[model samples]
Target: MSRFTTACIVGGLAAASAFASTPAQAGYYILRWDNTGICQVWSEAFTFKPIRWPSGYKIVSRPVPTFNEAVNLQVRLRRQGRCTL
Candidate 1:
């Protein structure tokens, strides 16, 4: 097969595996997009699945135990002028 075909297969597998994985933990995190300085509180089962494409967001805080905590963290980050949008 050509290189493009192989790459497509790998990306497809990564996306599928990312969806199929079981939950390892339940928590919230504050993610900031490096390109846009955008911050948001995300809630998802914690897993280390590989992404199928390039990513711009990174977690800025440890797994927060609750939604309230995550929101508080996001507020602080914004107040500090570190994250926005």
Candidate 2:
């Protein structure tokens, strides 16, 4: 690729990264399927509650990258004996 094209791509990526880093208002907890257990969820909306979880669950911010990360967070929270709904 030409130098100009490369520069534009890099610049665009930088701008996107900066925007992604900017903080936004917190949203309500939304539940997705926890494959670590036995649930196969089709929807990705948690009922708007005060965000409660069992001893092994954690209520993390929504929009996690992957299902595995969500499950890991849940497991960690459960390990800590904290409610993470």
Candidate 3:
């Protein structure tokens, strides 16, 4: 094949690979409140900004790759005393 045609094919493959390999966006989060055993919240938002909570209520924010993982982590955190249910 001509050099120009070969170059175009290579460049096109590179571009396609780059686009296909784009990283996933942040989407899963687990929110747990301190002092309340088994109190937890799940979110799909990229950011967590809690505005208010009862006194002594601590917010534990965990970013996870999947919803199931986030829920499992919340359970673990509750067991570990990092956050309540």
Candidate 4:
């Protein structure tokens, strides 16, 4: 097979894998500024299964609009299965 064909095949397989795991392995994350009075900022990163490819992954930084919102978002993200590692 040609190199293009091989790459296409690999990509297709990876896409399938990501799609299959997305429902079970997808997640999000959030960050909130704490009492340190903006002096301290919270940040986190997580990866979720891609929507259409298995080896595919999504890495995102947690974002929070307000301090209270941050806490709530964090909880939601955790429950959603956000990847910590």
TM-score of 1: 0.57
Clashes of each: 0, 4, 3, 5
Pairs of residues clashing in candidate 1: none
The lDDT of each candidate is 0.82, 0.49, 0.66, 0.47
Q: Candidate 3, overall lDDT?
A: 0.66
The lDDT leader among the candidates is: 1
Candidate 3 off by > 4 Å: 1-25, 34-39, 46-49, 53-61
Task: Give me the runs in candidate 4 sitting further than 4 Å from their true place.
Answer: 24-85
Model 2 lDDT per residue over 20-62, tens place = 9986533333243232332221114443443334423233445
Give the local distance difference test score of model 4.
0.47
Superposition error at 58 for model 4 (Å): 35
Which one wins on TM-score?
Answer: 1
How are the candidates ranked when ordered by TM-score, highest leading?
1, 3, 2, 4
Q: Which lDDT value does model 4 have at 27?
A: 32
lDDT at 73 for candidate 1?
93
Model 1, 1-85: lDDT tens per residue?
9999999999999999998896555789888877778788887764463342455777888988889999999999999998975
Could you give candidate 3's per-residue lDDT for residues 28-59 as a string of tens digits?
Answer: 66654544544465555636566445624444
Off by over 4 Å in 1: 1-25, 46-55
TM-score, structure 4 vs. true? 0.28
Compare candidates 2 and 4 on lDDT and give the better one.
2
